[model samples]
Target: MSWYVYILKCSDNTYYTGVTKDLKRRVDEHNGDDKKAAKYTKSRRPVRLFWSEPHESRSSACQREAAIKRMKRTEKVALASRV
Candidate 1:
């Protein structure tokens, strides 16, 4: 199965990074009010998908997510623009 590292632009203009096996379902979870919604994203509701990159394995996707999370906001924005 394909894994993905995704970036979301929150309603407050902040960004969130995560990994998921199903991008659509994950995004839905982030946007929904359900228990699955991340606390960070739940408050920053109505987030839009800014970028996503595919990976062959979950480990790779998680690694990418960690790298993106460590990046400065400007760096993340630049990366997102290239996607």
Candidate 2:
């Protein structure tokens, strides 16, 4: 199994970054009724997957996610558009 760092483009135009093992299911949870869904995206609802990168381990995926989360919105947009 592989770990992945993912970026979501929220309905209100904000970006959310996180790590996940299963991209499809995780994306569904973000838009699902489950309370465990990402808090930042729950209200923003209807988040679309903007980017993703696979990593060999959970640690690396998490590190990348954190780095992406720290980026400014313009930087994030640039990153997403580049790939």
Candidate 3:
């Protein structure tokens, strides 16, 4: 199965990083249009996908997402720019 590291830019201008096996469905959930929506994201309303990276394993995807989360806002912006 394909795992992915995804980033969402919340309506509040905050970014959320997560790992998921289904990128499209995950994004949809974050959008608060479904029952599976994350509580934190549901209140944030509209969220735009800022970046994504595919990984071969869930562990790798989670690690990558965590690494990205540790980055400074500028670095995150740069990373998003590169993507």
Candidate 4:
């Protein structure tokens, strides 16, 4: 399965990083009115996808997500712009 590292711009202007096996479905899930969605995102209500990178392994995707999460907001925006 292809893993994806994704970044979402929350309604509050905060960024969130996560990995998923199916990027579209995951994004839909985040937008859905489901209690299972992460509380952070659930309240954000709507999230705009700012970036995505496909990876051969979930571990790699997760590592990338962590790295992106560590970046300052401006740097993260630049990284996302490259996608």
Candidate 5:
């Protein structure tokens, strides 16, 4: 199964990084009232897709997510702009 490392720009203008197998479903959950959604995103509704990268494995996707999470705001913005 394909995995994805995604960056979401929350309604609050903050970024949330995560790894998911179904990007569409995950994004929908974030925007919807699903309890499965991340707690951090639950309050910051209406998040927008800022950036994403495909990965062959969940491990890689998770690793990338961690790396992106460690990135400074400016670096993350640069990454979003690049794609």
Candidate 6:
């Protein structure tokens, strides 16, 4: 199965990075008032997908998520724009 590394643009204009095997479900969780949503995203509801990259494995998706998390906002925005 394909894994995914994704960036979400939150209502507060901040970005969130995460990895998931099911992108659609994960995005829905972030936008919905569900227990599955990340705490960081829960308060910043109504997030929209800013960018996503597919990976062959969960490990790779996690690695990319980490890398993106470490990037500056400008850098992340640039990366998102390219997607």
lDDT of 1 at 20: 92
Evaluate residue 9 in candidate 2 and report its C-alpha lDDT on the 0 to 100 scale.
Answer: 89
User: Quick one: how many clashes does candidate 6 have?
Assistant: 0
- The per-residue C-alpha lDDT of model 4 at residue 15 equals 86
The global Cα lDDT (0 to 1) of model 2 is: 0.90
> What's the C-alpha lDDT at position 24 in model 2?
93
On residues 1-83, what C-alpha lDDT tens digit does candidate 6 reach at each position? 99999999999999999999888999999998578899999999899988999999998888898988999999998997885
Clashing pairs in 4: none
Cα lDDT over the full model 1: 0.92
- Per-residue lDDT of candidate 3, residues 6-79 (tens digit): 88999999888888998888898788566788777888879988899889998898889889989998998899
Decide which is better by lDDT, 2 or 4: 2
Which regions in candidate 2 have their CA more than 4 angstroms from the true location?
none
- State how far residue 62 of model 5 sits from its true place (Å): 0.8
The better candidate by lDDT, 4 or 6, is 6
Q: After aligning candidate 6 to the native by TM-score, how far in Å is the CA of 82 from where it should be?
A: 1.5
The C-alpha TM-scores of every prediction are 0.95, 0.94, 0.89, 0.91, 0.95, 0.95
- Candidate 5 per-residue lDDT over residues 9-68, each given as its tens digit: 999999999999998999999999668889999999999888899999989888899999
lDDT of 4 by residue, 2-83 (tens): 9999988899999888999987788888889586566789989698888898999988988998888889999988987775
> Where in model 4 is the C-alpha error above 4 Å?
none
Native-to-model Cα distance after best TM-score fit, residue 49 in candidate 4, in Å:
1.2
Q: Taking the candidates one at a time, how many backbone clashes does each contain?
A: 0, 0, 0, 0, 0, 0
- In model 1, where do residues sit more than 4 Å from their true spots? none
Query: Hey, what RMSD does candidate 5 come out at?
Result: 0.9
Q: Lowest summed-lDDT stretch of 10 residues in model 4?
A: 31-40
